[model samples]
Target: MPALQTINVSKSYGNFKALDKVSIEVGKQSIFGLLGPNGAGKTTLLRIINMISVMDEGKVLLNGKPVKQSDIRNIGYLPEERGLYKKMKVGEQAIYLARLKGLGKQEAIKGLKEWFEKFDITSWWNKKVEELSKGMQQKIQFIATVLHQPDLLIFDEPFSGFDPINVNLLKDEILKLREKGATIIFSTHNMASVEELCDHIALIDNSKTILSGEINEVKQRFKDNVFEVSYRSLSPLSLPAGHFEQVETQQQNGVFVSKIRLLNGNKPNDLLQQL
Candidate 1:
């Protein structure tokens, strides 16, 4: 069964429609990518799921049951906008947020410590949020979000404001969370990250769902049947006919590289035999 499912969900604000009959199913323990351009209603859909806003139409289910107010405890959300209290100490803020997620004081502190240690942020515990760098604050926010170990995790623009190394570190942690049985909904403009991490994706455009499917299947559907072949050759050679309809050859790093687009299902072996 899906970890989360939305059926014909829609949301509107005044005369503006933010989401139009958006439906999606997120499988258990999977990384589901929510992708779209700016002003495409991605944030509106996320707000509905987080219960920050009400949907104008349709319903949402979590683990096959209708979503309820109490179900908020089962979700960990990191919004695109950072919400840290600048005057508060990192540790205190983290604990408070975790408590809001239904964790006991003892559990929240213990879990926060473990996560801080894991992320190498233990030294930042007593520091005021304003004293930390943006990336450091983001780390604290991330710690707060996951400290309660909710079953579902939602991250919006998770890599924003982080350097490349930290971005990769966060990506690794996200994968780890999935392996540990958390269902993740990742909303971002980073198509490269989606290509790397998403098992499935749904793309929203103009407040409507324009695309949705398993990542590999979607990529395959978009494939142009192009292939690149590299081989070692000392001299230039005439190309074989059956290898491709059009072959572009180049010399790179002492090797002959060729990009081939097959014609009429021609096999690579047929070209190799002629060479």
Candidate 2:
């Protein structure tokens, strides 16, 4: 059974529709990229999954059963906006949030300590959240989100406010979480991150799901079959007229490299045979 599933979910405010029959299935231990442009209902769908808001129609399922209010305890969410309490001390706020997610005081402290040490932020434990930099606070909130070992994790634009090094750090940790049996719904506009991290993707546009499937399959579906081939020969090879349309050609190190697209709808194998 999929770890999470939404069937025909929809939401609206006043006369403006926010979501329209958006559906997605997230397999266990897999990374599912929720991709969309601004105001495309990504946040609304996430709110429905997080139970922060009720859907106007359809149901959200966990492990093949309809999600119950009680099931929310097993889910973790880190929204795009900052959620940390600014006046609270870093360690204190993290422990408080982790406890709210069902961790005990002792367990929360232990888990949070380990994460802080790993991130080399142990020195900031006693510092107030208002005193930390934006990137520092983001790390603290991330630790709180994952400390309780939730079954499903939702990260909305989690890469905000981080340097490239920290971005790589967070990316590695996300992959590790999936390897350890957590299903993740990652919402972001970063196409490079999507290509690097996601096994599958669902693209929403105009408040509706316009694409959903395995990542490579989706890319292939959207691809125009263009090919570039390099050959070492005595002279430059010419493509047969009416068979292939040449886009560009160049010579490098006595090798002829040709870029071509299908003009006559010739199969890729036919082009290779022609070469």
Candidate 3:
């Protein structure tokens, strides 16, 4: 069974429909990207999965069993919005959150210390959350989210407020989480990150799923039948009109290179034979 499945789950806020019968299956130990533009119901779905908000209709299943309220302890969620107690010390708050996730006080302390060291934030242990920079606080939230070692991990734009170096570090950690048998539901607007990290993706638009599948399969299915060719034709390159549609043309090192889209469901072999 898939690690997570949403069965036509839906939600609406009065006149505004946030999610419309959205269903998704996330395989275990894989990165499932939830992508959409603003107001595409991505956040609403995440809230439902995290059990922070109830779905108006449908249900969520974890490992083929109906997800119960108690299942929240099995999932760790880092939302897009940052929330922290400004007056509380960084380490103290992290341990508090970890304990809320079912860790003992001592266990939470030990785990938070290890994570603080890994994130190079050990120096900020006693500092109040309000004293840390936005990026530093975000790092703290991230550490708190995963410290419980939950079965499912959900990150909504987890890379926010991070530099390129820190982003790479977090990405590596996310992949490591997958290796350790965690199911990750990753939501992001960065298409490059999706390409780099996601094994499968579902694109939601207008409160509905518009596209979904394995990353490479989706790309291949959506690609135009265009091929770039640089051939030495004895005469100036000319093709029968309607046989090949030139999408782009350029001269590279005195060689004529043209990008042509095969016409009428024709394959590259047909174009090569004519060339």
Model 2: per-residue Cα lDDT over 27-109, one tens digit each:
88899999998899999999999889899999899999998888888898999876688888999999999989888999999
lDDT of each: 0.87, 0.89, 0.89
TM-score of each: 0.86, 0.88, 0.88
| Candidate 2: residue 77 lDDT (0-100) | 92
**TM-score, cand. 1 vs. native:** 0.86
Clashes of 3: 0
Write the residue-wise lDDT of candidate 3 on 1-275 in tens digits: 99999989989999898999999999989899999887799989999988889999998999999888889999999999878999998888998899889999999999888888887778999999999889888888889889999999999988878898989989888889889999998887776765789999999999998889999999899999999998765444677788889888777556778899888878889998878
- Name the TM-score of candidate 2: 0.88
Name model 3 segments beyond 4 Å from true.
227-240, 248-259, 264-275
Writing each residue's lDDT as its tens digit, candidate 1 over 157-243 gives 888899999989988998898899999999987778657899999999988998899999988788776677778888655665665
* Shift in Å, residue 202, candidate 3: 0.4
Residue 6 of model 2 has an lDDT of 94
